[model samples]
Target: MVGLTYKILPNLTAYGGYSEANRAPTPLELNCSSPTRPCILASTLISDPPLQQVASHTIETGVRGNLAIPAGGTIDWKAGLYRTSSTNDIIQLASLVLGTGYFTNVPETLRQGVEAHASLSIGAFSAYINYAYVDATYQFSGTLSSPFNPYADANGNIFVHPGDHIPGIPRQQLKVGGDYAFTPEFKAGFDVLIVGSQYYVGDDSNQNPQLPMYWVANLHASYQITNNVQIFGLINNLFNNHYATYGTFFDQTTDAQFAGNPVNFVSDPRTITPAQPIAFYGGVKVTF
Candidate 1:
């Protein structure tokens, strides 16, 4: 069967919209002594009980299209509008001191963001890229409320914290690749990927520079020895370029929020050492 189709219309598409906040679960939330009311600091309701940190809002809208090249192949394109708040660092929220016996960092966080992605393909080659921009902060309002002991400050008051940006979101990413067959029996392909900087959870040290830019190359090849048999091999870290997915020094978290917990969040979010060791694999296949 053979067919051809093509069309160019308006670039109009959108999502009704979506929201996400306080998504991260907090220790205070886990420490919920009661479910009906706001968990308390002592026996009284604290301003805000540790909840999934609190991301806030997200909007998604976009359009996409496809084209057929008759005997050729096809091409596709896509774009969109998106907004999202930083997610509360639920994992880090384990530091809020709910009470003398209760200490956790279920601090509320507020983050707003925008994101986009696009890609295209033709013949045997295809590629795509994605990007996200986030604005974040922390919330000190709204106190957690509970009946156990009643959460309250020395002044005996309840309030909620705003929210902050979520850590660990990469701002930009680029990936491109293509495949070509040298012969009907042998084919090989490769791709190059570039990743923008990323931040550790809770580390807003702009001066620290986002995770460094990193680029990596990957390659693969396959050969058919016979009609019923095939062989293949793959090489990773082809460029041998030094890079790190997570920074060099990883921090667990230690700070006042933990009372005495260490604010050891992963620092040096880069490859201070070097990229992973080169890796390669090969195999042969036979069919009956």
Candidate 2:
């Protein structure tokens, strides 16, 4: 790893760096590389070919600056861009068996992104904001087995080409937060988080509709009653927003058959893990 920094101005600076990393495959990844014979994790163990270690090279550049206001406030900001390329990338794919998957190594993959952050402080009030954009894609062409995928071919495999977006990674995200002091002993804060949509875990070929974007808000406050006692409260997901943080493909029909339910049923391959709903919490803190 190497890095460089230059002072472009009295209050500004530019910086860049390059780094290389290697990761060996885990025992689970090494033992479950066979597609024809999908293993059920610890229950089904088998011998498989060894996998190559994953290697990556990353490059990043950015600039940062601080500004002072004559009125009695300060501003700090930074922006940066980064790119990483990896070889022998290990990825998990669904197999012909229901509720099972296998791990395999892809020839190449890439992840590039931009990020920026800014903050302002004035007396008892402070605020900050952050934003990021990510473009994660496959750099090689190949086929993966995904029997549950609706678009899978006759052999229960899907063709993946270069430039296909990787599943389960959002392309954009934003967060804004601020804090205010009403008195020397009381304080309050609020924050908002927004996340962009992305492909499902099994939609590596990018053939299915993406998970919808969503946002959430939260509020918190605290009061000091005495030198040894304090009270705090928080309200999370203030708006009760309905969202899912993760999604994947599954066969509902097969599950019904196993349960001995009626066979006449509609098959919905989509499955999701829903995010938390609005909730409130409060507590008192005491110091000896």
Candidate 3:
């Protein structure tokens, strides 16, 4: 990676950078590629067909500056745009059998995005906001094998087209927050985070419903008991909003079939993991 920066004005600056990097496949992904003798999920097994390392090149440019306010306060802001192209990107493919899949390399993928943030501070109170938008997609055209191929026709062939959004990654996000210092010994703050919807794995065609967008708010406070001791507390998911961060479709027949009437009964195919519910934590810190 390389970077350069210049001072545009007394309190402003511009910056840019470029980077290239690579990552090797993990031991688990390197050894789990056989359809005839698939290893169990979360099992220890090694196989053949060693995977290729993922390589990426990226370029980014941005500007940041600070402005003085009338009340001896200041506003700070930053904005940036970045693009990255990766080759031989490793991705997981759903298996035909329930709860099992293998990792394989995709020919190419691309991610480009813009991000910006600003903050204002006045006296003992401060506020800040940030937002980002990402466009992540497959940049290759080829057929890939998968047991959970949602696009397969009668003949069972799976193919990925260029410009398909990669599954499980939100394209946009936002956050805003502020804090107040009631006294030298006390402070409180709150923040809200928003996540955009995304497609599920195996639904590269985007035929299934996208995950719903959700936002979460949190609050926190701290008090100083003495010069050497302090107490802090936080409430996460303050509204107790329920959401899922990840999801995918899979065949559940293998696990449910043995119960009863396997042939007649059908199981739900969507698998989802839920986010944490409203929660709180409090603790004290002491310094000698």
How high is each candidate's TM-score? Answer: 0.55, 0.91, 0.89
lDDT (0 to 1) per candidate:
0.52, 0.92, 0.85
In candidate 3, stretches whose alpha carbon ends up further than 4 angstroms from where it belongs are 33-43, 153-157, 252-255, 263-268, 286-288
Please report, as a residue range, the 10-residue window in candidate 1 with the lowest summed lDDT: 92-101
Cα lDDT tens digits for candidate 2, 1-288: 999999999999999999999999998888888887777764565788788899999999999999997669999999999999999999988888887878889999999999999999989999999999999999978887878789989998888999999999999999999999999899999999999999999888999999999999999999999999999999999999999999998875876687799673666788899999999999999999
Question: Model 2, stretches more than 4 Å misplaced?
Answer: 36-47, 224-230, 261-264, 284-288
User: Model 2: which ten-residue window has the lowest total lDDT?
Assistant: 37-46
Clashing residue pairs found in predicted model 2: none
- Please tell me which predicted candidate would have the highest lDDT against the true structure: 2
What lDDT tens digits, residue by residue, belong to model 1 across residues 181-228?
Answer: 778888888878887777543233222345577889899999999998
